[model samples]
Target: MEGEEGTQNAHLILARKLFLLTHPDVQDIEKVRLREEVFDAVKSDDMAPLYETLAADKIIEMDQSILDSMRAKIGDEIRKLDEKIADAEENLGESEVREAHLAKSLFYIRIGDKDKALEQLKVTESKTVAVGQKMDLVFYTLQIGFFYMDFDLISKSIDKAKNLFEEGGDWERKNRLKVYEGLYCMSTRNFDKAASLFLDSISTFTTYDLFPYDTFVFYTVLTSIISLDRVSLKQKVVDAPEILTVIGKIPCLSEFLNSLYDCQYKSFFSAFAGLTEQIKFDRYLHPHFRYYMREVRTVVYSQFLESYKSVTIDAMAKAFGVTIEFIDLELSRFISAGKLHCKIDKVAGVLETNRPDAKNALYQSTIKQGDFLLNRIQKLSRVIDL
Candidate 1:
């Protein structure tokens, strides 16, 4: 779980920079500082192509003089790399040639020239012969995908990595892939799949390039809360040692998880309220913040209603620390949308649970299927006679 530092961390920093760029609360001075930091980072890498691209896009002012200086250094460095590749290839040395190509690939990625970086990685992959090495190359490509938030590239690279693993890969790389794919799924709003993947990697996690172990646990808890049933949440998360170790460190995460599972509605609501700002500020979770809030509310309300055949609106409000009117409106909306299996008694100021009968539902489903089969048999007989 070693953290990335120095120039190797440029891409991740750039990804966060992109998020801060769009933050409404970011001050003008912070924007100026951000620009300077980004410029210093790219310039330190001697990224002529990336600098020119930024200047062309008006992300930064063009300094022709500075561009010329970077281009000179870049040209000299790339030429030496090319020379090494040529020398190695002339001697039919696969490993040296692969190393040279990989050096070039990393230079492009460090310079933020994504298309060229991908092209060079492909060249490096061609020189690579081992399945593990090929999977590593795909990991590099996946890094580029996340750096640019290019979903298509990330998706394709993940598929490629999985296929390479099927051809035989080490356990370490496969575990790392789970983290990458889990993050992608979370960013894309597939919380169910993301939760499963994150839970699977909770103990086996070895990669710190994506995030810290604490942050990883935080994600596992949040996603599992919304996706898993109460029983599974208790079994997998509330009782999981990996989660119990770190959940208390993350703000409100402990209260949020335990309050809901313990049926402490007031505490759950308070904890959930405390977490709203964090969710809103998060780059991945912000997009689905409202949907997540609704789902959490649904889960809590369903859990509360499951224990009561009928409950006074006032008592339910007191239980959840909300107004009677508020609970009435909330239950009405959920019931009308068919999300809750209960109805509100506005006239009597109560909520009446009407849980569906499993056996009856199953019987109806079987009768429908049997009717469909009978019709299909009749049609087949008619066809045969014809």
Candidate 2:
């Protein structure tokens, strides 16, 4: 990631390393691999201060001599960067000064120095004249925000980027920001908004620093499935060329998307089973794994049950490729939890759906709104009388 393309995913690597270091489920052998990776990253980036802190925390046990050597190398690099900045300020144009400051900011980012990276990014932003370069600095700040999972910084940067866009911004950066914001929404569990943003950027995705295109498609399809209705799902996701290309590359996602749409309940259930493991391991999705599972099942069950008012429990069980008793228990739990608008007739081995009628729902909503308007009018009348 430190290649000529200049896309530094150092924070993502660091996050993975930290996750592995502290994860209870990470095997000891994996920890060994992480230690090797940690030192390798530190050496390549010359993260002397970071290395010292990790060593002090007993996360690593590198020798003092290695630390001292790294400190010397890092100090030398900082001096050279400072010299470049000074030279740019003394003799060069604004663009050159911006480049120099950006270099320092990127250096701090590469070395996992969060605070310094942000400070230097602001300095770079100050020197940046155009809206595009200023937005680029925001993107860097956003990278650090993601690296640390700092929601406040992320939210403020998103707002600032939006305001900048209002003044002026490029389409490519605007699209990239959508992906960034979508990822933030995913991390925050705002799946509906994330779904919208991901789908919007599906055709224009180029934010490789945040994640690969395939992973982006994966997020797009997953969020789209849960948030979209059948018509919108078919239009935006099931038929979208961008998603169709990579959806098959991700395990079970293709089946997960198609089977539900095609009313292949058994296949949908099978694909969901496989997807559970993938979601459970994903750092972004892990916390919401069980919740997602329940929601997915609820969606699938509602879809199947919506076809008929009453159906035999045995038939429903067969449709889902599960035992009758299992289907009975699932239906009972979902029914009691109000996730499913259905009831079970245990004696008759039947399941009946009782979804609300749309017209009746609209009528009730209208009545509620009328009451609210009447209340407001009465209050206005009382004020006029006073």
**Candidate 1 residue-wise lDDT at 35:** 84
For residues 221-264, what per-residue lDDT tens digits would candidate 1 score against the true structure? 88999899988999999999988888899999999999999999
Per-residue C-alpha lDDT of model 2 across residues 311-382, encoded as one tens digit per residue: 999999999999998998888899999999988989998887888899988999999999999999999999
TM-score of each: 0.88, 0.90
Pairs that collide in candidate 2 are none
Residue 47 of model 2 has an lDDT of 79
- Identify the runs in model 1 with alpha carbons over 4 angstroms from their true place: 1-9, 25-33, 47-68, 363-386
lDDT of 1: 0.86
